[model samples]
Target chain A: MTRATLLTITAPTGTPAEGDAGFALADFDAPQVRITDLSVTRGDGVFETIAVIDGHPQALEPHLARLAHSAQLLDLPEPAAAVWREAVAAGVRDYRERNGEAGSGELFAKLIYTRGVEGSGRPSGWIFVDEGEDFSAQRRGIRVVTLDRGLRHDVAESAPWLLAGAKTLSYAVNRAAQREAVRRGADDVIFLSSDGYALEGPTSNVILLADGVVRTPQTDQGILAGTTQAAVFAFFEERGLATEYREITADELRDADALWLVSSVRMAAPVTDLDGREYPVDAELTAELNRYLLSRTE
Target chain B: MTRATLLTITAPTGTPAEGDAGFALADFDAPQVRITDLSVTRGDGVFETIAVIDGHPQALEPHLARLAHSAQLLDLPEPAAAVWREAVAAGVRDYRERNGEAGSGELFAKLIYTRGVEGSGRPSGWIFVDEGEDFSAQRRGIRVVTLDRGLRHDVAESAPWLLAGAKTLSYAVNRAAQREAVRRGADDVIFLSSDGYALEGPTSNVILLADGVVRTPQTDQGILAGTTQAAVFAFFEERGLATEYREITADELRDADALWLVSSVRMAAPVTDLDGREYPVDAELTAELNRYLLSRTE
Candidate 1:
């Protein structure tokens, strides 16, 4: 008798991850399939980047919870948690298998759950995984550009009814701004809203320096509330360093003592420059946050 | 001497063949390796969607011209035109061999020129040919939702940036908005600026109702300016009906006599409903435009 050869890819010892966070190509059969599927095929979806440390995806629960909220805001079906945990665990496993060791460097875990595949004739959803960039710059800090690409802020307040808090993909504009910043010889971009307010970074989280307290845009600014940003803020609160969330103008960012682009991937990187001018950082805070994060990981 | 036989098995075409537009996907065993070989993988890329009609890709010249313009905008190194024409022709020939008879529906030919795929380690551009929606409703019309989905007008005007016009694969937000509308039981969506000013539809073109005149948002409104929308405008002008491009508001749309969603695939479909309210159409004007489009195509 022929033996039944079964290939069983056991579920990893974790939860299924979900988001429009990972990468996929834009190839779909029917164009309308994209409309109906509302999947990532049209390259329109928002995502958040989270860091994986040791054997665990850092801030996994908060990230997943926020992803659910984002999906709901975007009017997509809330993906089951088992699927999300599995997807993320798979990503972590794949990273460990190929890279062989977690090392001191972080492993990036992006949980991409698109709405559907184009012309797949199926209700769309897929979990994708990929490696992320080297965020060593977080330790050393990085240069950035404050670009007046004329993004608007009042639109967020007036049209709070829109997908303000949802991290939907339509990011070609953000990517373009980053490229424009690169063309101007900057490493990253900070988009300036039309009213001269400082918006978020292209892909990183945002924090600013005003007076003495560190402040970032409130959740209502239509910005994706970053898990890392939230985590770091909690860390600050524990340390008794005051932090605030409020509207900030470009002048504030330009004149602040220090500005950090925070994210799960970036952790926190101080911006040393904006446009063509340079801004010096307060070295004490940089070391303080890095130490706090490293200690927490330990 | 033994003759070498060439194997010609069936390939699943992504879309139906029409005007020589069709496509089939081929998987690479080691996608990571192939990406390095294909120069088109550059993340910053541009594309043009051309319609295929009656075994011939209509608007070939215009499509290529637009491709060149998009390439220039992205600073992509353009391959020779002769090479492009030949590549497109080969794609068409392959489609013709498979479909057997002339196709009755619209075919969408997408030419992708990219900077390079991230981590693909390849230098390649991709050509995606697929089919699209059959606008059987153009003979009737469509229902649409006017949504203030947080798009801004000034940002589109002052910067007039590339992402606003370039047909990039980064379309997650546009797709998300459409899905949001769908959940609300609408067929499609038209985005309004945060200020309640009209922008454009998610994928289709835009034409607004007015004092017995058909108007579209100025190209400055960051609309894609569909070829069909242009054709309808030309037809109206030829018939001595006034057509103009200017700013429009949601209130204006509600006050107009009729509205339309236009595209290359659907041609023009009257928007019979906005939000949940019913909108009546002018049977006479709808018929006149339909006749004009048919005659022009013939």
Candidate 2:
């Protein structure tokens, strides 16, 4: 099935009106940024991806807060959240109208702001809405490899310039880790700090269920706080389950009753294997959590 | 002076012939990459910048080698260096022709290859030639701030997936460090490893002259090997000066007889002051090295 896409360009002076269906997904093209644009050239930018369900973006407030935080971390001008909200709204509305109701399974909304061309002093910003990937098969159960992230848990606190918590566009290393996992016959990777602490997955946050308690790595461990994880923890609290954020070691992950990689789109995925060792899949728990997540989003 | 830019797009099926000057610098624009493109959405790409003097790119061989190395580290298919060379040649030629002889200043030639939209398996490749910045004022002497890179010296060896040696487009952290340096009233930054090793600069490689020997951090310290530093060392070797590739501690950097940051475009910039500590300018040595670098390129 062809995924519908919507593009919205937001400039400082002239903001493109919303719901402009004049441009088709195939016809959408980005204006050529100067070759010197730091975003394109050096990956000097910050971005956020939100999941859209039934034409509404989920967890937008948290995402926007994180995006703003990322901008400040990178020393970029604070992005106008209101402008971004309008763009996301327009993009989703346009996508639904063009693709029709039958195409409304799920959509991925992306917001990007780049430090524009050198000396222009203008930041380039855009919003994109596209068809989301179907993760049903993998969400049932998946395999992950443990890879070293090559940094101590304290590095982020000691070095704010490392941009540990900010979701900047310099994701080459993260992508590389994912690629390596695929090559090794795993579905994803769980990155461990140099000192052997389980930090996070390449694109998701690591969650461990043990003794009826839900735990994830502390955000202070230099990992991007997962929005979905936050939502899930809130769900857990509402359901009267214990939730904790603390440093988790690689050994602790192996010893947990169940493991899941959580993200915005994938929601909660049970891990069937890690480093070729089989793990028990808590099918009942996975299903219950997925249902709760969907209901909350609705 | 307005910088001249030339853009060339190469696709899987079609290779745009060389010297196609039909496009103008002002009229050039990059077609919008699909929102699904990993390069744009995930910054999954590799790039190289070569110094162009009188329309000829300097240190082409080393830069190409490093690009290929970077591609390998990212698990990207090996790039066709010949194609990149052709694109560079065509871009330089077209840029010089359109900009006129009066625009004979230095140019920065860049090559980029991004893993294109997901599932297509096609890589997007391009070459850009644009006006270079004049470093005359800053080249005389500059101040630098020391920042922690937040990774130990041996992390790259333990974590290959971190892409430590690869010159990937994920440079947001590097740019942030430089921005912080500027905020601290410095011209650049020399990154120190978490373990207190003087690693490298945000963009350039750090070189220290002490006790009649020139020393730079070993590439194995998770740093990108600097082509310009290699060339300078070759020049030094030819001139009978001793050179060493070994770990230089942060304290050693402050104690060195002289320190310089070397890169493709900026060439060699002497560090006049580091962290508010002043050092004598080795004007004669800096001038002699620049002449050798330029003369060799010519």
Candidate 3:
């Protein structure tokens, strides 16, 4: 498989020249952030990963909007969306030129903006593009375990400093939870708030289908609003399917007719098992949802 | 001020050469980690900051032990302490040889180990040495505000995946708490558990003196074990001063005869105000404690 990485460093004054904007993985070998950069040292940054198909980003507007919200939550300077869009386009163009048309294969386009090195007053922003992998093996199904996120569902309303809904780079706990799930022979983790409310997965949104209705936890419960999940909900609604965003319990999740973890890259992955208990899989629905997600771009 | 930065990268097979062991801030201008590096994308890493005085690192062993503990908590491989020691030595040697003896001026020695670029099977580890500034201005005194950490004191015990005590690179919340404190006209913050128990500061441990006895919160309350605070407690104990480690309340902290935030670099900084309420300042005790900390080395 061919892999490519494109980086465009936006300086304090101007963006990179067009000739200097193409793809190269070797350009990333050297040191980029200062040791004092808060993003590297403290993870004080926000990011978004968009799926690109045929050189077009899926849900570009929504991803940019979410990135802006995350930046606001982090007290970081709002990124210039136009600059990011241009960089993403340049990256996609470079990737296709080098690795051929994306076609069925996809690219993960990432936008990262970090509170730069201390006292420099310049935020370090860049776009990175890489080949997306086939999730068919995972889409065949995944098993997930429930882990305690250790935060009350109502904390985000009162404690904004917790950064509950922001997609900051401070993901050590999430990564550790995923590791714990793998240790328990599961593929992913669904976090439960300390108060027993179902929260979210380590890196994706959790959704359940029951009695012809689709449901997910409310975002006000200190969870990031999932872009892919939003898109899927809209698609389902357009097709005359019922959808609801409300409080979900672990018991309800276990009793659901079907469960799936949704993300931008993987689109939608069916949950075959939960805590060693097998669930009924609706292969037809899963495939249809995947097809809709992969083929639709907004 | 003469500033220097020394980086030593440990490759998959071998470490960098001696000639590449010195300090240069310009060496950090380039990209260090791949965009796919979990350290960059997910903040899946652990780090330590050691204080260096006149080419001698203070409490190096304790810092390394804590770093190992953090790595273990994150399920990362235990870093080779001897290699880190060698790298630190080289950095200090280079700093002193280039910028002359540190004397009273200090150096901040940082050790970082990331999960590395994805799928590379290699961990990115480096030791960075930089000049530390005089914090006499901040150490003279600081104003702090109480903020909710948004977690119960027992959360760490209930959910190990939260990594409450590990000093991972995921410190965005900590940074946000500090920023909020500053916005509230304070210099720092003292985090309180959701249950109203006085926890530690964003980057330091809180210590209070009441009726001639020194006290700090117990580490079991989801707070990092403070290496400097432990050293200070030992020094005070050796001098026949009373000390205790137990649960502390915000009210007790507000009503304390004196309070201080202790850390590796700043040592002990008196907290003059909490939530706009002034506390008594014992200058003689503060100086004596600083003298003991600065004069003693392990």
Best by the lDDT measure: 3
Please compute DockQ, using alpha carbons, for every candidate against the native two-chain complex.
0.25, 0.58, 0.67
Better of 1 and 2 by TM-score: 2
- Model 2 chain A is weakest, by summed lDDT over 10 consecutive residues, at A20-29
Question: How many clashes would you count in candidate 1?
Answer: 40
Q: Predict model 1's lDDT versus the native.
A: 0.59
**Which residue pairs in model 3 clash with each other?**
A30-B31, A31-B30, A31-B31, A31-B32, A32-B30, A32-B31, A32-B32
Q: A1-298, model 3: which lDDT tens digit per residue?
A: 5656556556422455676432233354444555567777788888899998767799898898899899899898877776677677777777777777543377888887788877787877767778788888777799999998888887778899999999999999998998899999999999988788888997899999888999999999889899999988987898899999999988888888889999999989999999888998888878888888888765
Fnat, one value per model? 0.27, 0.63, 0.74
The segments of candidate 3 whose C-alpha lies over 4 angstroms from its true place after superposition are A11-31, A101-104, B11-26, B101-104
lDDT of 2 by residue, A1-298 (tens): 4545555454422344575432223334444344456666678888888988777798988898899888888888887776677677877887788788644777878887777765778777667787778888777999999998877887777777888888988888988888889989999999898788999998899889888999999998889989999988987788898999998888998898889999888889999999988988878878888877665553
DockQ: which is higher, 1 or 3? 3
For model 3, the DockQ equals 0.67
- In the range B1-298, model 1's lDDT, one tens digit per residue, is 1111111111111222454323233331112112111121112455566666654565666667666665555555553454455556555555556555533345555565544434443223444444555566655867778776554665544554435655665565566667667777778888877677787887777787678687998876666656778788888888778998988888887777778887655567888888867778877878778766644432
Instruction: For each candidate, give its TM-score against the true structure.
Output: 0.78, 0.93, 0.94
